[model samples]
Target: MENRPLIGITTYLERARWGVWEQSAALLPAAYPALVQAAGGLAVLLPPDDPGRAPSVAARLDGLVVAGGPDIAPDRYGAEPHPRTAATAPERDAWESALIRAAAAARLPLLGVCRGMQLLNVVRGGTLVQHLPEAVGHQGHCPTPGVFTRHPVRPVPGTALAALLPEAELAVPTYHHQAVDRLGSGLRVCARAADGTVEALEGDGPGFLLGVQWHPERDGDLRVVRALVAAAGG
Candidate 1:
C-alpha cells in the first residue's frame, strides 16, 4: 500500500456579501477530517467552485469522498422543487455533478454521504423523492437537529457494504429528507430502510463506488473511510 492515501473531499459553496466563501465554512460539522485522518488517509478539500480543476484535483488524490451539504437543484433530474426543499445552489450542483462523472470515469474510489449520495445518484441518471415527509409518510429522517439516533437498516449480504460493516443489523444517524427514488445505471441498492427507502448503493462492477444515506463521519465510522482508502490501494 502507498505510504498515505490522499483522499479528496468535496466542499460546499457559501455566499457572503463581502466575498464568495468556498471552503467548509463554519456551518458544516467538522468531524470528517478527523475521521479520515484517523483512518490513515490525508484529507484534501476540493471546492465545488473548482470544477475546471477536477483533472488536477483527481490526479493528486487516491480516492474521493463527497461530503454532505445543501440540497441538489431539482432541475438536474427534471423536477420542480418541493415545499420542503431547502436552499439549492445551482453552481455547486453543476460542479459536483461534473466531478462525480469524472471520478466515475476514472474508476476512483468514491464514498458519498447524505446529499452527496443524492448527487451521485442523479449523476448516474437517477431521480430523487423531493420531500420525504409529504410523500413517504414518516416524521422524516432527522426529527431533531444536533442529535443522533439509531435507525435499523438491513444490508444485502454478500455486498461490499455488508462485507465492510458485517453487521446483519445496523443503526445509523439520518438527517435527510430527500432520498434516491430511482437508482443510477450500473449501480445496485445494497441496503434499505424498513420504509423501503434506498439507504446504500454500490458500483455494479468494481472500482469502489459506495454511497450511504447516513452521516458516517458524524458517528466516527472510520471503516467507511478506511474502505475507500484501501480501495484506492493505500
Candidate 2:
C-alpha cells in the first residue's frame, strides 16, 4: 500500500440540516479534502477538540491545513470587536490555535487559508484591521456577500510564495473583510493586493508554514497545497 502523507484539515461546527436531521454538525467544504487528495495526501477532518490534545493530533499527521471559517474573536488578539466583523467562533479559535502551535512546534508542514491565515497572525501576537473596506476605501476584496471575487496579488520577489507562483502577479478567488495589520513573530509578508492588503505570509524560520488570504481551494489551484504535500514527504 502506498504511504500517502496524512493531512489534517480543521473543520467548522455549525447548525446544519440534511434529510431529517437539523442540528449542530461538523462542517467542512468538500474542496478542502479534495485539494489535499489531489495533491497526493490523505485527508483527515479534524473536528473541534480539547485544545490540550492538539499536540497529539498534530503528531499523527504529516501536514496541517487550517480551513477557512467565520471570523475569529477579536479578543484573542487583544482587540475589541468591530461593528462589521462577522460573529466570532471562540471554540474553533481555541482548537485551531492549539493545532497551529503544535504543528509549528513539531515543524509539521502547514497551510492557512482565509480565516485560517488571519488566525495564524493572531496566534503569533499580531493585530488585525477588523473591517477592510474602511481601511482600503474599496469593496473589491470581498464585494458580494457569500460570493468569492477575483483580484490580483503581487508576490514579493525572492519569496517562497513567489517561487511557487512564477508569475509576477496572480489573480485569485478572494473573500475577506479583515487583514493582517501587524505581522506575527517569525513571519514575513510574501504577497500583497494592489491596495497593499497583505495576501500571503510565510514563516521566516524553518518548516513549510504558509498562510494565504485567498481561497486557493475555490479555484482548484494546487500549487500551494502541493507544496505542503511535497514538503510532508508525500
Q: What TM-scores do the predictions have? A: 0.90, 0.98
Error of 2 at 178 (Å): 0.6
User: How well does candidate 2 match the true structure, expressed as C-alpha RMSD?
Assistant: 0.8
lDDT string for model 2 (1-234, tens) is 799899999999989999999999999999999999999999999999999999999999999999999888998889888998785578999999999999999999999999999999999998899999999999999899989999999999999999999898989999999999999999999999999999999999877999999998999689999999999973
Superposed model 1: Cα runs more than 4 Å off: 15-28
Residue clash pairs of candidate 1: none
Q: What digit string (tens of lDDT, one per residue) describes model 1 on residues 1-234?
A: 448888888776664333654444423356877778888888888766657767666766789888898788888899998877875667668777877887877887899998888999999999999887776787657667656566878898889899998988788878887899988898899998888888998888968999999988877568888898888863
lDDT of each: 0.81, 0.93
State, as a TM-score between 0 and 1, how close model 1 is to the true structure: 0.90
